[model samples]
Target chain A: MSPLSRRAFAGAALASLLVACGGPGTTTGSSTSPPPSVSEASVPPPAKSVAALGRSVPVGLKIPAIGVDTSVMQLGLAADGTVEVPPIAAHDRAGWYRHSPTPGQTGPSVILGHVTVGSYGDGVFRHLGELNRGDKVVARLENGKSAVFAVTAVQTVAKADFPTDEVYGDVDRPELRLITCGGPRTGDGYQDNVIVFATLST
Target chain B: MRRTGLSAMALACAAVLAGAVPAFADGTASPTPVPSRSAEPTKAPSPATSAEPTRAPSDDQVSVRPSGAPNTGEVTPSSGSATGGLIGGGAAAAIALGGGVFLVRRRRANGV
Candidate 1:
């Protein structure tokens, strides 16, 4: 083969290989599906309802008040002992901490999402600050059951002073904490984390 | 003609090396580290000296929901995708290296 053709073939082959080897768990920016609108008045009152699964694994999250309906990805801890966030490419998806109790379990189940991705624009939780007390947050479990939670409070605390105990504290009833970076942007990143505390309503 | 063969071999080798770099880097990167907190000793706390008592909510106020049905369906865990990435990168590196070696051997055999 001629030198030019040979080089061209090699370049094409390398490019194809790179595209094929693109990592897993990396979203292609196409998986995000629009969520349905839920209104605060439409939400039912809290009830002692049974969950669908004994150890329900949350697969999706929906907060109608803030217009958030996104798939949930399970996240493990990073090397630095901090919870891992979803890839920047998947800013539309929320990540649930796998180490924590599954939603509907008798402990705090934590769900995290990015507030904003650098250039791609607002993240899944960009409007998380708008959630108010008594808003409904629904977690759809893998077992086809849903865990509905009622927002009790929304607090924006400095990341330096994260209330780890309060967020992850053991509870007799199932609880949920939706976390995202918020407050003010600083040189490092978002200075504060917005945490919404919720209890299993049904 | 010999110079052309040498140039082709060199280009193939460079491509192989370039492909191998990412796989090598991934091989060196360790998996997520698990925290080790079991070494700390559990100590009994002394009784509170403060006059203020910790308020405990009444059982009636606490709501306990029954566990839902015992469905054993398993959801795939999501943490192993990084390993899949490493494997894909390694396979790409191997294929690139093998192609380079085959090209070099063909050129030499052809006496070009």
Candidate 2:
């Protein structure tokens, strides 16, 4: 090739090399299973961040959108030092982590439910993955008032990669997190945890 | 001229291979280290402020930070796949190879 053509080719090559090496992130392969449906597409962005309400113990929860209506029980730490889950026998009922802020209080209030209760079949949050953004989740409090939350996002993350900070971390506004086992079950148990994030809407 | 082209091809391949090594490393998901509660700084109020009856202690004050998730799943196997790296890597490698050939020829013509 002519010297001019050669120089042009070298410049092109350098550009390509930079582009290739520029982003090693492209090497991340597609997951074996389809990526967890963690879309925030439908949920409309809040016009304004919701204000927090006064503290009150959550007595019950209702997610009419996904048909989750269950009494909320209190959950403390287990012997293993992890947050507790609702009893396996009453897996249909949801339990709120007492350590977390109450439903209407500032910071994330966590609620845990089961997808399946052994042979008992579908649990209360079996359809939690179906919740979309803009959907409503109502938490009845001991003060005889209810806190309404709008779903912001739903994600199915590997149990090992459970987003502890995002789930339990403090937030300025009152927020709610619904957690349950999801994804294909392996010999160990459910492979992932389905988390639904919501912010106080009303 | 042919020698220059071959040398350029070799250099380009080496660059591509070198780039591919990191790509492979990046594809595998490393186990994330779980944080311990003891390692975290305590957010409790000082003793002087603990006994105030006028203001109820917040939930965080009364409660200990949870160590980890309350997940029921254990020993869940991770299935990581390695792909997509080739598409971008290959295209970039080809362009680099072309560039390498040109540069090599230019250098060879200059008799350096």
Candidate 3:
């Protein structure tokens, strides 16, 4: 090809590279490697613990400043692995997955609760949406000790931006995440998922 | 026999070197850093940063009515459609007009 054509091609390729690298978290964000998993080979695994979201879960959740003291239940993915929440009254319980980590245990401990109950006064976790960075989420372990997590960051992700890797990524520090419905209401469903990312502070 | 044990240790070291460790007990963090071998370095979120309500989430809220949107003042955990459908004006107009004329006549004839 002529020098001009070659130069133009080079510029076009450079532009594409720049665009890919310019976005948020493009290289260092949610799209990175998945968090750790439980296997025979996990180097330096955290700890072995258990909670239940099926028929059992950890005790209630409380954040003093937020006035949120609700039960948490164990939650999990259905057959397809989409998030499965406990029934409405199941709030104030941590939805512990039989297969996932326990609160203050190894791996990601996922808990689901209702933001509100239909038209009622809202469920116990109703105020979960109000949690911000540095908020504390305390869960009483079956051992009588409380596992405390402080809110790290809060993001309102469109349902499509769930960031499965990020929300459930494995970190050395204990963490907490609060999920609820948000975004503009639509005929079919809510517009987005309000994902609150927190870390194990206490 | 010793060779087998040695090989197992080698693979474990490789997994660790490849940044194979995940960080949190929960599944919201990246792979665990293998001490000095971890490629990506990230600090555990500090415990004492006061709440910043106005600050944005990492990119990634509350009560709801079991509807398309969450109730106000509650957290919203939702996702967006990855691929958009045909939302062009033409499709919308056609959907409206095609059904519009048919339903209009029905309504008028049924008027009481």
Candidate 4:
């Protein structure tokens, strides 16, 4: 090969390797499309319904099934606009998305937590995938009432294919979504997300 | 001359990989540890006593209804683009390394 062509080839190979590895602020392999919004009429009703609780800030969460009893922190959007997770030092704590409906309110209430922290290990939702249908989750509210929800589903999906609409879409009754990272590890990060869907119990 | 080019390419690749390891780690869902923060013990605020003033329930109260109208004070999730920080860094590295290769070729052509 000509000297000039050899140099060009080397540069091209390096560029391809960099693209395959990905860089900061870039996500590859995940679907970039917007989540589909399901109409309210199309949503199935809860198996057992209860009255929605009035406005109450969630302060703590307890899931007896997975032995989770962590304090809930109010999480707002990060500067990048995605929902923020709890700080690493507080990995044992779960964070409730303040913008979503408060637990027990009529909509999908989101609570996000870490699955693990680098070196620190074992985040609050590390065992979140173990939750099953018919298990119980309790959210202690600032109003001195506890919102009880029964687990409806548990799913682990690739981070690139996160079910945005199904997890964040509006619902007819008060619903709760607990999210954390799980599945196979890709270098330092997990390749998938674990979500627990639940609804208020009668 | 070929050995020089090969060495340069190897060095560039090593540097890019070194920078990428941490960036990949940062891309995880795990929260970054902040220096000044610790997990605060959360306490549920004291419940209102009967002596507290009670306001009449307003129509805006969250209720179990068939309608899917958004609740007041609820923040809708943002449809912001996800951060591809790792990918962006990798792309930048590629461009930088490519530029370095061009610079070397230019120097050689000039007989520098």
As for candidate 2, its clashing pairs are none
Instruction: Tell me each candidate's TM-score.
Output: 0.49, 0.57, 0.45, 0.52
TM-score for the first chain in candidate 1 comes to 0.74
Q: What would the per-residue lDDT of candidate 2 be over residues A131-177, giving only the tens digit for each residue? A: 88889999999999999999988888776777888788767788889
How do the candidates rank by TM-score, highest first? 2, 4, 1, 3
Provide the TM-score of chain A alone for each candidate, in the order shown: 0.74, 0.79, 0.64, 0.76
Tens digits of per-residue lDDT, candidate 1, B2-97, equal: 999999999999999999998888766634232223322211111211211231121321111112111111112322444566766776677676
> Considering summed lDDT, which 10 consecutive residues are worst modelled in model 3 chain B?
B59-68
lDDT of 1 by residue, A119-172 (tens): 567788888878888999999999998998988777766666677766766666
Per-residue lDDT for A144 in model 1? 95
Worst 10 residues of 3 chain A by lDDT: A34-43
* lDDT of all predictions: 0.65, 0.73, 0.48, 0.66
Better of 1 and 2 by DockQ: 2
Backbone clash tally (model 1): 1
Residue runs of model 2 more than 4 Å from their true location after superposition:
A1-31, A34-47, B1-63, B72-112
TM-score between candidate 1 and the true structure: 0.49
Question: Model 3 over residues B1-112: C-alpha lDDT tens digits?
Answer: 9999999999989988666445334344434445444332222111111222222122211110111222222322331221112223334445445444544555556562
Please tell me what DockQ candidate 4 reaches: 0.06
lDDT of 3 at A172: 53
